[model samples]
Target: MRTHSHPPGHPHDDAHVGHGHSHGHGTDARRLGIALGITATFMVVEVIGGLVSGSLALLSDAGHMASDVAALALSLFAVRLARRPATPERTYGFHRVEILAAFVNAAALLLLTLWILWEAYTRLAEPSEVQGGVTLAVAVAGLVANLVSAAVLHGGQRDSLNVRGAFLHVLGDLLGSVGAIVASLLVLGTGWTVADAAVSALIGLLILRSAWALLLDSLNVLLEGAPRGLDVRAVRTTLGGVPGVRGVHDLHVWAITAGQPVLTAHVEVAGGADSAEVLVRARQVLRERHGLRHVTLQPGAEGQPCEQREDLHT
Candidate 1:
């Protein structure tokens, strides 16, 4: 027998319905729009500059900027999509779209990194005479644009993985811009034009480093793994420690989207105790201590023979 009640302050309570999708949707969309516009405009400038200067580093920056444009646009679309109300057919609405977008952005960064590395190797082997003056001027401009874009996105990155993915793209562009500047100075000062490829290779390495973290995070989320920094065992211990909660079994916790965690568990209550109070305490404990809001708790008598008991560790 499942016994429970959603007391005041419970996230799943009636008064708080649909709050998940509505929170921060508009702000995220606006930030993404601004970032998209900036990335798209700079990408055009970089493309033309790369063609005119014949600088591999500049061309690579343009490529990274291009991906930034796509990532920002996709993030905006996802922010909008994630606002849809949950329905019978799609209970979670479009929450997972943000995760999917993050994954795509990370994958795009990896592919771009590989391409940049290959191009850098070829340029190094051939040692093209890149126009240092044009490279320097264009790189300075690209760096300024990327810095602005990064600032525009900085606020949202810490809170949302979707925003973080776009932010990472802009950071990659920023790295490319700095690389182009260094390479241009090297080529102009000492006539070592191979610096272009060397710096481009360095940019690829930096991007690969950041991209690997994002890819792993996205893959873990898609695999339904627990959110980073959340300890499931700790949560179980805390839940079990709730007054009248004899044991916590079948506890499961995972992120439905960035910052939105969902928890479901069967809480066993000691005999002759009010399971109602136990459920309330359990929910409150999770919310107050673990920062978990969307919780579905099933209360059962202690030592009850639950047939679905095998593999309960999850």
Candidate 2:
């Protein structure tokens, strides 16, 4: 017999499927708004400063700040969208919007970094005069603004990929500010205009590293890969070890979004075993051992014909 059984009397049920979507997002939205305002205001200033100073480092930092403005705005929109209730046609609601925003932000960062690198390369070939005094003053101001924005977003970043992407952008801008400051100092002290391009290139490399990591993480979620640090083989082994279970197959695990994992499996019970009791124990094991609360299990007798294709077993 095929039994579609869930854990009975479990506190976590379908109602809790999108728990993170509702709670704590208000704080996150507010944080994003604060960071957005700060970043937008400074981005314009940095652009003007870059133009007046003619410092490649300052110009590259301004470019990154521009991308930060966009990233923060997108993150704020995604946070609001994620609050929408699930509809019949869209069972998972708009949670994935956050992941999409993160992906887009990462892509933007990568592109901006590449552009900065190219610009720096050209500057290296034919160095230009940079106003070290103006660059230093503007870069210090930008650094202070970035510090405030980064602090505002840091609290929410660990909980949401959308927020994390914005945080990374702001952090990159912070590094760029530091690079600009260093370049300005080098130029003022030793008349080495090449420091401007060299420092800009270094900042681009740093941003590239962080952007690539965010891109991969968001891509994995979009592709429905298992959550990070979760082992499918370990989950299967645990299920097969459940008392009265003859075998386990058709097991699948994937995240709807970060911190929200879902699993489904087919379990074969020994002949004459109490399927209901076996299911309860299995659910308890999964919940306690593997932190899997959102689960669906199909229980059947040991000799029952496999309803799923053999190739699909994990």
Q: lDDT per residue, candidate 2, 203-268, as tens digits?
A: 999999999999999999999888888899999999999999999878889877777788888888
Model 1: pairs clashing at backbone N, Cα or C within 3 Å: none
Residue runs of model 2 more than 4 Å from their true location after superposition: 1-8, 308-314
Residue-level lDDT for 35 in candidate 1: 83
Which candidate achieves the best lDDT against the true structure?
A: 2
Give the TM-scores of the predictions, in the order they appear.
0.94, 0.93
Clash pairs of candidate 2? none
Candidate 1 lDDT, tens digit per residue, 40-136? Answer: 9989999999999999999999999998988999999998999888889988778889999999999999999999999999988898889999999
The alpha-carbon root-mean-square deviation between model 2 and the true structure, to one decimal in Å, is 3.1
lDDT of 1 at 294: 77
Worst 10 residues of 1 by lDDT: 305-314
User: Candidate 2, TM-score vs. the true structure?
Assistant: 0.93
Find the number of clashing residue pairs for candidate 1. Answer: 0
